[model samples]
Target: MKNNTHHKTIRSFVTIFVIFSSLLLFSAQQTHATPIDPQYIFVRKDGSSCNPSDCSQFWSFNNPDKINQAAIDDVLNKIGTRGNNNNTRKIGIGVLIHYNRHNLNNILASIDKLLPLATENQIPLFIVLDGFQYLNKAPELWNWWDQDQPGYDLKNRSNVEWTCSNGSSCATKTAWRNWASEISLAFPHPNLASPTFIQANKNKLNTMLPKISSWYQSLPQDKKWLLGGISLGLEVNIGGNYYHYSNGINPNAPNPGPGNSQSDQLGYAAIQFLGLEGGITSANLDKVVQNYYTELNKYAYQLGIPRQKIFDHVNSPGFTLPNHIITTPESSLSPYGNPAWSFYNGDAANPQQFDTLHTIFQQQGYIEWGAAEWRAPNTTYSSWYQAFQNNFNFGNTRFINISNWERIRSEPEILKAIKTIANEEPTCWVTKPQINITTDKKSVSFKINPGNNNQKTRLHISSSSEYRENGLLQNIDIVNVPLNPNSTYSKPNLSDGQYYWNIVTTGCTNQRRITAGTFKIASQSLPGDLNGDGSVNIFDYNILVAGFGTKYDIFDYNNLITNYGQ
Candidate 1:
């Protein structure tokens, strides 16, 4: 009896030992795994001395003296080095240049000086080459809005319009192509000797319009690398009060059909210019109107404008992709193909819009896009930080540009804001969360190992891949689960389709706490699977046929073509 009891006790000890060893192994794997990719944030410094109040008039092009060296030095002195002053290590500096002035010499000279500083600091520079402006008030383009020019119209039409006085005469397409071609030629290999190119185009040079290509061609190779990426135009969308002007004036205004009050020459011009007729049906009128921008995108590519080079800028809201645009040269896909966002706004009213933007870009297979230009909302450091934080704290955005270095040099708060973003440490995860979907596709189970004993696991679930809605985070469902080494949380009644799960440990003492578990759901439904039955069958076909020739008709057809009978 004594021997049997001793043997039983030994067995009990072995069982406990096995369980404890398993737990420790699991903990070790959770704590030490591959890290998430680093996030990059940048503070943009404008290379020009343009007026802070108005971006339209009294512009000087590329004055090396006007490059704001003091501001550059100040920003560099503080935040140029990663992890400097205990700030985030991934932040870099960005320099913006509108080198499309009458003489590219000024911007070129400015860039030459700035590039070495950027190189010495190991930073990336962003270059913006302005495209055609319709009624550009610059003194050089005397014929821009002139009434007697070939494209001009009277009846206050010419006075009230943007871009071309009439639809047919706008040089936007030519100007876009020219800017790209000019920049590529101007920045040819070996050296930045653009004087000869300038001399060759001297007869044709528009003294008022910028010499962007000439300026680029003039820069040395070392100087060119500072221009990591070139964004064409400040804001590429058609400008003016076209949306508000229903009374025959704004060139970019919507056409309210043939007999509406705002319907007239300008409306007809827009309709014709956008190619909206074939897709137009009574029910799909709104869709056709929305597709007008898509048509603008199509027309832009048709003009041989390099989507690869142009980071399409959106100064206002409502210019984002409605669905997706399938364009050519695969390299020119959305986000990258039609990359756009706002420079003036602090945050999107709809957080889901950011997710949708990421989804659209990802669908086109782009790994990253850029945050639009950043400017301090108010004079305070807190306000600037909030503005910059709200805008840059989105997914898959790799680059950011500030309005001017002058602000960095002069505003103590702006530099502080830059430091704050630069020093931000990503939340670390003990282990990647494991996500499981039940067979019925109605429930999702998430399991994450807690990072710290004091930390609570924060869980967020979303139908969206990016956990956002209408460009905001209003739609994401957040729940805090108790800290457990292997905690399981199951959410039932989830609709069929793709879902995303993000798990991060909270309440940690470390300021550099990282977020570990980010995962997507297991299933993907076909695009044409309208009934959510997991397959595109006869039912989906019927739905597509019924909705044919309507707003989403094109998308349906695309779905059918891609996933027919699947």
Candidate 2:
């Protein structure tokens, strides 16, 4: 009996030891697993001075001295050595240049002023070409493609008034191609071949590709890496209000036909430029846009800009064609025999938009993708954090350029979010929890997963008032509530207001916290509270009378009468 008891004790001790060893191994793995980090490109709009209030119009080509060195230093100091450990998250700068007649000089001067700073910091510099305004402002350039003759009325040609002066012409296909040709030549590569469109206009255009090529070849070998890439244009799109005037148009115009509006006129112009034999149908317009970008992309590639470095910056994913056909920039440029760069603007409120874009780029076999321009509402730090998180969750996001310099300098929360991303620690949650509010606004629930390892974690929730002030959460309502892997937790009777929540996890050596996002509880609406001031009094009655039949009706009046004081 003694021998059997001793054997049982030994087996139990061995089992517990094995379990403890396994947990220690799991914790070590979780601690070392690196999270995804994306490169951040801060856009210096118009090469302006760094002062948040400084509105100097010192064009880099004309006055490179006005470009503040302090601004560059400030940005670099804030971003810090986070990139030193991970190359993927390296910080870079984007300079927005509005091309003019002296574009070559502008490019050279801008490079001379900025490249040294970039090289010293060992970061990349991107040239963002913004020439749309110049296209309209310069008649000499505009006339080269679409000349406005003495008697020609552009309004008559498109049935809507254009922003161009009475006799000035709107952009034509030739204008776009010529602009592309000029940019290509100004930033030339050795293996470049003139596109067929450029070949057609060879007699009219001049060759600066050789000189540009020489300038690039003359750069010191160490400085060559500073030229990260060039954006062909900023938010390349068919001329909207930029080219056409938008007043005096009927709002209730008929659909599926060209109407007397700026959009309709732009569509009419697009049809002519694309050489399509049809009216301004959505299908026709989609074809026009796709063809324009495809050709523009080809111009850059033909000029020997590496397919990886060339980015087509379209605002939306793509235009929807008839029969629910969807087209993205990736899809349009992929069939031209090479994988094109997939870059877009991140202005969408829906998270699924990012997911859809990421999926499209992957399906199209695009290896490089990013947001060349991303902006968040200036209201809340949560919005900014969510924006960064959304972009970071997608692994292929190579770089994201925060739109303007002023936003960075002015918005403290923007810098905070950027710093948080730079210093993010690995978390134990394999799938992070996201709070979902009930339809009745009475409760909130979330699900979490710690994978097979079942790492230790705690969840917390707090009202927005006590959450995220100066980078710390105060007055947390639910403190360190233990969470189980793959289990759902519900907190009932949540009051009618915004709530913030997060998950805290402890690894073997460090602790990590992650925001699970926010939830809002909106109480049921009171009857007859037209102005939503929590009561139906004389003010509500006054509002009803003021809005009369347009905004409020007899039903509203009756409701107010029934629930007058309460």
Candidate 3:
């Protein structure tokens, strides 16, 4: 999405900046006016790899106790109850789809169990197609390197399976295309296709895209959007691409060979193998990447998916895309040294590097990016969450692996922060609303143009001069009001003093609120009403007579003269 396109004018951008600033100053974890849509938190047991070095399946498949409907409900209930108070649903599971059939079937079964509950709570599910139905470790694909294939120069051909349709290298693109054709719409998986069969049929990607989209369209309308989208390949950077040759970087050559300067390397080489002449030069790498995207875009279009819907998964520390969603999987802060933390370390004081990279992506016209598998360095899960909140903008989508659900459950602060961020409804770029205020001495009122007439609206009045999310300030009163631009709320029984107030309007999936507006209630007393009665007459005269001879009587005499007739 274009920056200038989303914010039509400078004023709109300034307004958002101001609102964001106010939120920073006053709201620590207050109820937000807006809630996030498709709020996802990864569930372990179902998503975590079974092994450390390489995970081919989820633990849930082998151990049912690890993930169940009850566990899923617990997460949604805990994290989806803030902004919109959608406890029944809203929290989504983030799981991985691998080349294994049983693992795929097991996940689908979990989704089936989850569907009913999800429907009630508006939850959407996420899937990471780990390696697209091709297991690089399977013996046929792994140990059996095709010595006959002319240009197969890379070590362990099975280690890198994403290559073009050349007879020699068995890792062909057709495997993905065929798997795409085999999966069902509701919860897609190839029809009992064994890993070996998929590995052997790795040459049919051309037929896959269209079939995948057709299945998508065939699903029930309610279920259609549940498949949020798939990240093309899991963390496309380091799957095995870090291999370096003698002069550095080149794993494949025109003929089969052994070590040192292998011809075609991993990712960058795959593109050239698909039919590009120039090779992977620093000058041509970017172009190669773009052309690679262009090719993927064609398949995505065939699948009836939009460019924005296809998230680009990056495993590198620094990745900038001119216009695409860059999703980081297993991302962490630098000191964690997990090797997943990209360009910026999790340093609070020196965040400029990450900011700089983010700026570059934005300048290239990208609107948003996020971490798919994120955790902080050496902190409790809750602190890890807080670190993420402190470091990144919550305006973009975020996710946490559910395998840590136990930690989240144990840490109240982390759970609270997660819910706060998750419940903030996301506004589409075009429909975001702004607030304006009007005030008088006794009352404060606000208006949201393009008002949410059908949804609930809240007006909060506080004696404090600024807004506070915690509502710890004295004399804070909140009231439910009609969601109309013309509607005004009056402060009741205000003790003739200044007051500050704000209004928040909530819609089905979006919300907007205004900053505090100041107003004062004037003291109500007539000049001659000395006795405090409504009128001035004998009551005032008698007081004057009682004190006629003293200094107090002098003041009484002044009052008597001033209101003698009244």
What's model 3's TM-score? 0.44
Which stretches of model 1 miss by more than 4 angstroms? Answer: 1-40, 46-60, 78-93, 99-101, 108-113, 133-228, 239-310, 316-338, 343-362, 376-393, 427-566
Q: Tens digits of per-residue lDDT for model 1 on 1-566? A: 99998678557545644654575566455444432223345566544454466333222334555444454455568664453332223555555444333455555565556555555665554555443232222223223345554433222221222232343353221111122121111110100011222222222223211333344334443333233344544543322112222322333324222221232212222333334564322223223223322333333333333223234444434332222221111212232234545444434322234454545544533333555565435677777766655554544344566655545555677777767766765342122223222222355565554433225555655554321211222245543444355656677666555554445443323211223222233343668666555665454555655565674455565575478567
Question: Which pairs of residues collide in model 2?
Answer: none
- lDDT against the true structure, each candidate: 0.41, 0.46, 0.40
Candidate 2 per-residue lDDT over residues 1-566, each given as its tens digit? 99998677557545634654575566445433433223444445545344545554333544566554665665667555434343334556777765433344545555566655665666666666544323322233223223454223322333221222221354332211121121111110000011322232221112322233344445453334355556644554443212222332323333221221223234444455446675545456456545544454445544443344445555455332232222244433322112222232334322346455656544543334556666555456776777777765553344567666655755678776676665563222132232222223366666564532225667778884232211124567654487776677788776677776666544322223333445566554878876544555554655665786799765675687689787
Report the lDDT tens digits of candidate 3 across residue range 1-566.
57765446445435534654575444423222332223344443344433443332223532434444555566556665523353212455555554333443454444344445444554465545444333432333333335664323334342333323342443322221111122211111111112332333332333333444555555453344454444443443322222223232223344322331232233333433445455433333333333333344435544564333344444445543322222232221111011112222244212233554454333432223435444444235455555545434323333333334443454666666666655654333112233445333344456554433225555666665421211112355544455555454454455566565544444443223232344555542544445543345444444544554573434444454566445
Deviation in Å, model 1, residue 224 alpha carbon: 11
Off by over 4 Å in 3: 1-67, 77-90, 100-117, 132-227, 238-268, 274-301, 318-352, 378-386, 390-413, 423-566
Candidate order, lDDT descending: 2, 1, 3
| Stronger candidate by lDDT (2 vs 3) | 2
TM-score of 1: 0.42
The worst-scoring run of ten residues by lDDT in candidate 3 lies at: 332-341
What ordering of candidates by TM-score runs from best to worst? Answer: 2, 3, 1
RMSD of each: 20.0, 26.2, 23.3
Model 3 has an lDDT value of 0.40
